[model samples]
Target chain A: MGGKFSIERVNEYLWEIPAEGDMRVPARIYADRNSIDFLLEESRNKEWNALAQIRNVARLKGIQMAALAMADIHPGYGFPIGGVGAFDLEEGIVTLAGVGFDINCGVRSMVVSIPKGDIEKRKEELARELFESIPAGLGSTGSLRLNFDEIDRVLTEGALFSLKRGYGTAEDLEYIEEGGRIAGANPSNVSLHAKKRQLKQVGTLGSGNHYLEVQYVDEVFYEEAARVFGLSEGSVVISIHTGSRALGHQIGTDYQKVLRKASQRYDIPVYERELVGAPIKSQEGKDYISAVRAGINCGFANRQVIAGLVRKVFARVFSTGENDIRTVYEVGHNNLKVEKHTIDGVEKELLVHRKGATRAFGPGRREVPEKYRDVGHPVLVGGTMGTFSYILTGTAKGMKDTFGSAVHGAGRVKSRKQARKGLSGEKVIEELARKGITVMAHSNKGVSEEAPDAYKDVEQVVNIMEGAGINRRVVRLRPVICIKG
Target chain B: MNRNGHETLEHTADMGVRGWGENIETAFKEAALAMIGLMAELDRLRIKRRIKLECSEPELEDLLVEFLNRLLSQIDLEELVCVDINVITIERLGGNYCLKATAGCIKREEVKERLLVEVKAATYYGARVVLLESGIWEAVCVVDI
Candidate 1:
């Protein structure tokens, strides 16, 4: 750990580090005075620096305008958590660093017909049932045992495969972005080892910050959007936040090795080796994009399975039927999607890489699901367990500003060591119970590491997104129960 | 100041040992001793079991993660408690790398407690090993518990 890297204010909400050394473009960050100051203080003299991460991102080959960091930014291996970068399809490079280890690590929120009061009555049983129904923790295996062929279909088809398997419905596919599958995934691009890892782990929630949360719509800020989402202020909801598990990790790892070698061979200079990459249309880049999309399919299918499990748990606890529970939307966070975004008044197909960030397309964007076209894409901002989570919708202003991306969660403010030092897993659990939030975990330390206090205020992060007009707060749901793995 | 921080132990000219946090270090050190104990006593030839440990992550988080995972797996396979460690190096180039260590093994007769499950590998998902401002070397490695 060293000292703080300073920032220069570019505008009211945008800060920057000038194009330096190998940086092809300036590094920009979206933060107010408060968050910016906090980041500057927290990153003082450590190997981790969002500034450095931003700079490295700006250096990615064929980046347009600037490399952007979202409000909830935090230092990560190559790109910061809430970092975003865009590269031209003709010449821009796609780096795995921008997508992260958990490919398609995303949020899937569903609305159920159950009343809030009734949910409160059965919350205790619901929490326990959910914890058991959903396999979690390290090396936890799901009930599904898939052969390579089945895994390939699941990877290629995403949620559609689950719908075909009778786990989900065709209607669910209509509600999902990209119909729950990203095109260009070649199962052959995925390694046998990766497939082996995915065999028994499809529906399992690998530990550390991954969770299945049950929430209720606390209030609605946008009535029409709420109506469109099939959610009412008091409607009970379920949110599953997870990713491609072992399969995605392997894809990212294998591609990173290839990218690192590719960068060297191409004579591309990066601030760090982890930031190595090549153009999205290049042979190397196309292979990774294909593999990553397949991984995205894995995640979508995984969430669908988990959603089925959620319905099962709810039915077992409340004695209800599957019709009572339904998925609202499944959104990807850590991914690179090639989309047309106007840069300098010209529309170009750019590889938009969002790491620890979520897509928040504004109203009228053809990419948004039909139900949400009038308002914008629904953005799910998860809070720490035992805190209030939020459902926000994208805004038109966001399209003009941040390429329609928003913060994923209250960014982690404390390191795991610092979190563990101040809080004990047992004590954190007791505190949550005292706050009327039921919690369950396979590991004690897991609970402590994810204590609400370990992160920045969710309200503040959401407020920033809302205030910036990138996303509008639709509803806030306080978690009455949470299950951690 | 405590075992939870970095505590160094002398082993031989080439290898030594170190404990990680207070709890894991105590466990890992015990694991180190167990490995050494196995090495010391295995010359007599009793039983043999081939053990495999696997942990995943990018290169940066590998050094501390793999080191801890290797020890944890040895503990499960050998059914012994390791109490000490003499660490040689925790370095990262393209990825993570570990050089040397020394440890002690718990005698079977002295075993009074066992862990929740076998630790197959330590992953890099949330692993962080660094020396802090307070002179504490902290790591947040996850084992395949």
Candidate 2:
């Protein structure tokens, strides 16, 4: 199978997989030489291969250009994690695999006025406060329990619903993607079972790689960009990484059945059963798009509520005004968005599906918030529990190349079980504490699974994006307090 | 190695459950139990309630996914963790494969503190249900977290 696929180096930072067999378009990968070598090595084995999954995406109907994979590309259920693709509105199809099961799973960063030195002194207390305030781990329930009507409003209104309920201020909405509300969300497209699952799960950080971290800007790469994005060396910030929870999961489960049937009815050939999709104009496709948008809203609202909770903790812990803590940006990695992009010298509407990838719209794009319109949207890239996360800005070159997208985080290098074998949660906690970082988790098993060595070097991942000119580095954030599920 | 049992398999980001038994029905039951164990400590959960599930699909693979997803839905709706599964019947009906099973669930409160990981949905990736030449039945699949 590896021999069947030939990859040609287009440049130092790009590789191309030419169209072959049933593939309608070629596939391009953005990675440095080392990352490409790692991928090639992985391709040698017959197990779930990322390159093959990328090609399978190319075979999907009405794929506008080529399938794209970021430097963090890894084998996922259907679409490779860190994969991106766009489909023609009139001819392309939508698949549940593209958006992923955890719909709109994303990262949001908030800047605080406190300095790094002050946070370092209170890291332990802050970690404890955040861990207790934020419900985490498997089946963790939050304070909010919505009924049928309230759930419908959450599906439709998104973060605005949370705002109306006094979770956060109106200003927070401006920094959120889609103003914290994805339009065309139809609660009717969501099932009652899905709603029931989300009734008590909102604002909770579900397990497995989801976390809340208190960090400080350790290094400023592009000083001007950092200034414009409200960052300074040694300033403290908080990052929340989570998604739509059970609601999004149920939506994916419900739609997989519909799209599988749609594939059969429309006579669409599925290379992998998980890659099944229906034509974008077909009834199944429309319904899925609506339901996914509703799921996206659920994510926005969840993060918004969590952000409010974080602010409350910060105010109590640091004795700072809540108004001083402000959101820098909120962006979803697993999602599908209908956007206008220039293709072949023509601007066309395409449904862009980014799985384990983040949207990095360049400056002047209307989608970017007005305050930072001249500096481009901030791309929040979260690292593993003990590693350094980065903030990068979208580039015009990225808009021209990979549909204004960048790698979401440091891709995993090992399986959780393998990570747990060599690492102990208590040992990891002690090591971080020795380095002046506070760590808290509900389960030692969760901590062992999220060991820092399990992930690739995030600095290297970000450097590739910068080298490729897809995204510009802003600042690097090192964790002071980390909380895991 | 056991005649009917399940084991947790390693996946890079998520997790996998692989089960084996003497027949397909038992293999499916083992897979369901594996999924339950991954979510929480199944030993601590008591069978407080029982729910019957019936599903039919044209493909055996789809039937397996449906079976697991139905169990997941029951967990979310009832706010409970499944502890046991009893396959009453599994047979080919016309062109479709049909399954009827009873799932016993315990209230979430009983095992909330013991929960380890939350599985969102069972995916079709690398899914397989096969009868080996050794006359043993096997089923394997990955679940999203």
Candidate 3:
């Protein structure tokens, strides 16, 4: 419980945990009053609270600035789901838990020329076709069966490998974060077991909150930004939510042991064993970063392949050309990146870790693609299966306050079991059907567990982000067909 | 010592599994079973093949994590949908703890029950191994989905 910690309100949308105990800096949280109240109630019931995790992160060596939690903050393994922290490149450390097991787990959205009315007419058929074309659920394998050498290429090349193999075109890579590939990826640093697990799972959509949804732009909040991103009212789009599959999971498992040992060798104090970290300059740290970058590449490749499959399904179902479907942008939520930022009037390169949070680089930032340089990066916030998603743009406030990070999604409020107590999968599907939304899932229990009521109201979450001045809403998407794993 | 059994614990985002037994070996086996149960109904799984695994760690908690992660890796790499630990042995060798086990594996095609969730990995968060006053061994851990 959070009874042992002292919390003070900094503003309407921000809260602070003063530097105390082992904390080297203050911990900041961006949330609405209601959300803060919910967090207080959650802390009383949950053994591991998000606030404590934030405080624990502040105690990490060489951490620059404060540990920040976004509007959708929730308790997670070592770092809260919406946790963000930046560490000094020379003296800071990297923790496997801070980046999460599903490394670079992110969202990619594509806008099509089709209208909402047309999509609604063939919603059921489209959902079925998508389910058939794209593999989903546990232990699912894709069409590609690469050997050890080929797997290494994927680890190093990322989406570029998929593009070269004709899964997608070269233009698709332009909008992806880091051009769909991260630097310093070394397949040699990755374990053989991790490569083996990723052999046939390259294009899979692993289950548990991962999904592919067909949605329509119901409203535009920022007209200019929406136009620049090619999003318009009544236009249909497809969003793929997943991560690096078993490849990333294996990397975390492999490096967790290394970091645990490195933490001791470096004499870094670990509040939670899961938060074990190693100095960036240490051998263990270099190995972990190289392997994680590979995992990030795997994630980018997986989403690119899935996007290609979605395009294929759309071309067949709607009888449109492949070129008609174009990618808007792709952003990873769970990742660690080395970026230059001004801290106390000094430009320093810091390794920023964003877990269950998305990078929202503001306008004029070099990281922002040339096309979006004047508007800012597009941030995709996926809601639940039966709810509405939002597209927002980065703000200068976010860059200065939280390193340009935004909430990833509507964080879970209820446990999966609690959501499935009396609800049946058939009832959920029926309810969504009544609301004119088509639902297709591999398992009925999966549908019941992802019921819309299980999560916080995404509208409120996005509102909090807007009020906090971190991200400005550009458009709102209403789901027409949801394909769940 | 208590009887060998396993139970699912509630977590906000993911889920947890707890297993207890008279010995650490039984506890490990039950913990594996508990995790598999979360994925699919185990009663309907057929034991098609046998897999041998061995790993060692300095701490009991780390050993449990390694053992469970090994089973999870086998499930993904070998396309296993269901599995059961047939025999498990835990021993202390000098400064390290060693674990050896044989698992009964079932392929995806063999599973008849509805698949639930794909557990990503066993995390160190909230992981624990303790001896109760009744002399029973208990292992509790959370798995990322």
- Top candidate when judged by TM-score against the true structure: 3
Chain B TM-scores across candidates: 0.48, 0.95, 0.93
In terms of lDDT, the poorest run of 10 residues in model 2 chain A is A42-51
Model 3: per-residue Cα lDDT over A1-485, one tens digit each: 56588789988889998989878889999888898988887787778678778888898888889999999888888899999999998889888777989999999999998877788788778888998989998788998899999999898899999988878778889999999999899999999999999999999998889999999999999999999999889878899999999999999999989899999898988788799989998899999999999999999999999988988888888987777788899999999999888777788899999999999998998998899999898999999989999999989888888888999999988777788885798999999999988988877787888899989999998998898898999999999888888
Between candidates 1 and 2, the one scoring higher on DockQ is 2
DockQ of 2: 0.70
Pairs in clash, predicted candidate 2: none
C-alpha DockQ of every model: 0.08, 0.70, 0.74
The DockQ value obtained for model 1 is 0.08
Candidate 2: list runs displaced more than 4 Å.
A1-3, B43-49
What does the lDDT come to for candidate 1?
0.72
Model number with the top DockQ: 3
Classify candidate 1 by CAPRI docking class: incorrect
The CAPRI quality class of candidate 3 comes to medium
Q: List per-candidate RMSD values in Å.
A: 7.4, 1.6, 1.4
Better of 1 and 3 by TM-score: 3
Better of 1 and 2 by lDDT: 2
- Candidate 3 runs further than 4 Å off: A1-3
